[model samples]
Target: MHPELYLSYSSAFAIGLLGSTHCLGMCGGISASLSMALPVGRGFRFRQTLLLLAFNFGRIGSYSLIAAGVALLSTQAAGQWAWAGLLLMTLAGVLLIFMGLSMGQWWQGIRYIERAGAPVWRTLSPLTKRFLPVNNAGQALALGSLWGWLPCGLVYSTLGWAALQPTVPSAALTMFFFGLGTLPSMLATGYAAQWIRSIKSHQGVRKISGILLILFGLWTLPIQALLNL
Candidate 1:
C-alpha cells in the first residue's frame, strides 16, 4: 500500500476511535440495555460477549454497505472529472472540521446534520423495538443493523471521509477499519459503563481529541499536498 493511502486509512480508524468518546454518550445506554436484556445463564458472560460482537458486526456491515454505495457514486463522478477525489475530500474535510468544532464545544453545527438524518432514523427506529429482549444472535444482529441508521453526526462525518476514497474496496475497508476502531469503546460500554462515561466527561480529553481531529481534517485537504511540494 502507498504510504499516503495508508495514512488516510489510519486516519479513518483514528477518527472512529476518537469519536467513540462521543459514541459513549450516544449509544452507551443502548449497549448497556442490550446486555441486560440477554438471557441469564451459566455462560452469561460468554453469551453476552458473543451477542455484543454480533451486534457490532451487523452495525459495521451496514456501514461498509453505505461506504460501497457512496464509493460507487464517487467513481462515476470521478470518471466525469479528474479532480472529483480532491473536491469530495475537500468537502469531507470541511465536515470533519465542523465535527471537531462540535467536539470542542465551539459550535453546534453537527447537530444540523443529525437533524437531517432524523427522518430516516424515525422510520428505522421503530423496527428495532421488535427485536427487544434479544434471544438469539440473529435478533441481536438485526437490531444492531437497524441501530446503525440512528441519527449520528460522528457517523456521518466519518462516512464522508469513507466516500472520498477512490475505489469501492478502499472505501469499504475504510469504514470497516472505522468500525474496528469503535469496537473497543462500544464493548467497554457494555461491561464498564461508568469508566467509559468518566472518559467522556473529561473536558481535557475532548479538547485534545477535537484538536487532533481538526488537524486530521486539514491533512486531508488537497492543498496540503500542494503545500508539501
Candidate 2:
C-alpha cells in the first residue's frame, strides 16, 4: 500500500481506539447482553466468544458497507469535479475535530450530527427486535448488523474520513480496521464490564485521546497539499 493509504488506515484505527469510550456508552450494553444471554455450561466461555465475535463481525461488516457506499458516491463526484475531493477531505478533517471535542467532553457539537442520523436509525431500529434474546451466533450477527446503524457521532465522523479514501474498497478496508481497533474494548465489555466502565469514565484518558485525535484531524487536512501547489 502507498504510505498515504497506510496513514489513512492507521489513523482510522487510532480514531476507533481513542473514541471507543464513547462507543461503550452507545453499544456496550448490547455487546454485554449478548454474553449475558448465553447459557452457562462447560463450553460457556467458548460459546460466548463465538457469539461476541459474530456480533462484532456483523457490526464491522456494516461499517465497511457504509464506507463503500459513501466512497462510491464521493469518488464519482470527485471524478466530475476536482474540487469535490478537496471539499470532502476538508469535511472529514472538520468532523474529526468535532469528534475529538465530543470525546473529550469539551464540546458536543457532534451530537447534532448524530441527531441528523436519528431518522435513519428510527427506520432501522425496529428491525433489531427480531434478533433479540439471541439464541444463536446467526442471531447475534444479525442483531449486530442492525445495531451498527445506531446513531452515533463517532461512527459518522469516521465514515466521513473513510469516504475521503480514493476508492470504495480502500474506504471499506479503512473502516474494517477501525472496527478492529474497537474490538478490544467491545470484547472486554462482555467479560469485564465494570473494569471497562471505569476506564471509559477516566477523564484524563479521554483528554489525552481527544488531543491525539485533534492532532490526527489536523494532519488529515489538505493544507500541505494546497501549499505545495
Candidate 3:
C-alpha cells in the first residue's frame, strides 16, 4: 500500500477503536439480548461465543457493503468531475470532526445525521425483528447484519471517511479494519457490559480518544499538499 493509503487504513482502525466506547452504549443492549436468544445447553458457552462472533462479523460485512456502495458512487463522481474527490474528502473530514466531538460529549451535531437516517432504519429495523429468538448462528448473523444500519454516527462517519479513498477496494478495506477495531469493545459488551460501560463513562478516556480523532480529521484536510511534499 502507498504510505498515505496505509495511514488512511490505520486512521480508520483508530477511529473504530476510539469511537467504540460509544458503540458499547449504543449496541451493547442488542448484543446482550442476543445472548438471551441462545438456547441453554451444556454447550451454551461455546454456542454463545460462536453466535456473538457471527453477529459481529455479519455487522462488519454490512459495513463493508455500505462502504463499497459509497466508494463506488464517490469514485464515479470523481471520474466525472476532478473536484469531486476534494469535495468528498473535505466533507469526510468535517464529519469526522463532528464524530469526535460527539464521542467526547462536547457536541451533538452528528445526532442530526443520525436522525436523518431514521427513515431508513425504520424500514430496516423490522427486518431484524424477523430473526428474533435466534436459534442458530445463521439467524444471529442475519440479525446483526441488519442491525448494522442502526443509524450510528460513528459508523456513518467512518463510511464517509472510507468513501474518500481513491478506490473501492481501499474503502472496503478501511471499513473492514474499522469493524475489526470495534470487535473487542462490542464483544465485551455481551459478556462484560459493566466494564465496557465504565470505560465509556471515563471522561479522560473520551477526551483523549476525541482529540486523536479530531487530529485524524485535520490530517485529511491537506492530503494533496502532503502528497506533493
Which one is best on TM-score?
A: 2
- Worst lDDT run of 10 residues, candidate 2, spans 220-229
lDDT of 2 by residue, 38-77 (tens): 8889999999998899999899999999999999999999
Model 1: per-residue Cα lDDT at residue 11: 83
* TM-scores, all models, native as reference: 0.92, 0.96, 0.93
Backbone clashes in each candidate structure, one number apiece?
0, 0, 0
Every model: Cα RMSD to truth: 2.2, 1.5, 2.5
Q: Judge candidate 3 against the unseen true structure and give its global Cα lDDT, from 0 to 1.
A: 0.86
Per-residue alpha-carbon lDDT of candidate 1 for residues 119-204, written as tens digits (9 for 90 to 100): 98889998998988788889889988888777788888888898887789998988888888888999988887788889989998
| Alpha carbon lDDT of each predicted model | 0.83, 0.89, 0.86
Q: Identify the runs in model 2 with alpha carbons over 4 angstroms from their true place.
A: 224-229
- Which residue runs does candidate 3 get wrong by more than 4 Å? 39-41, 223-229
Residue 223 accuracy (lDDT) in model 1: 87
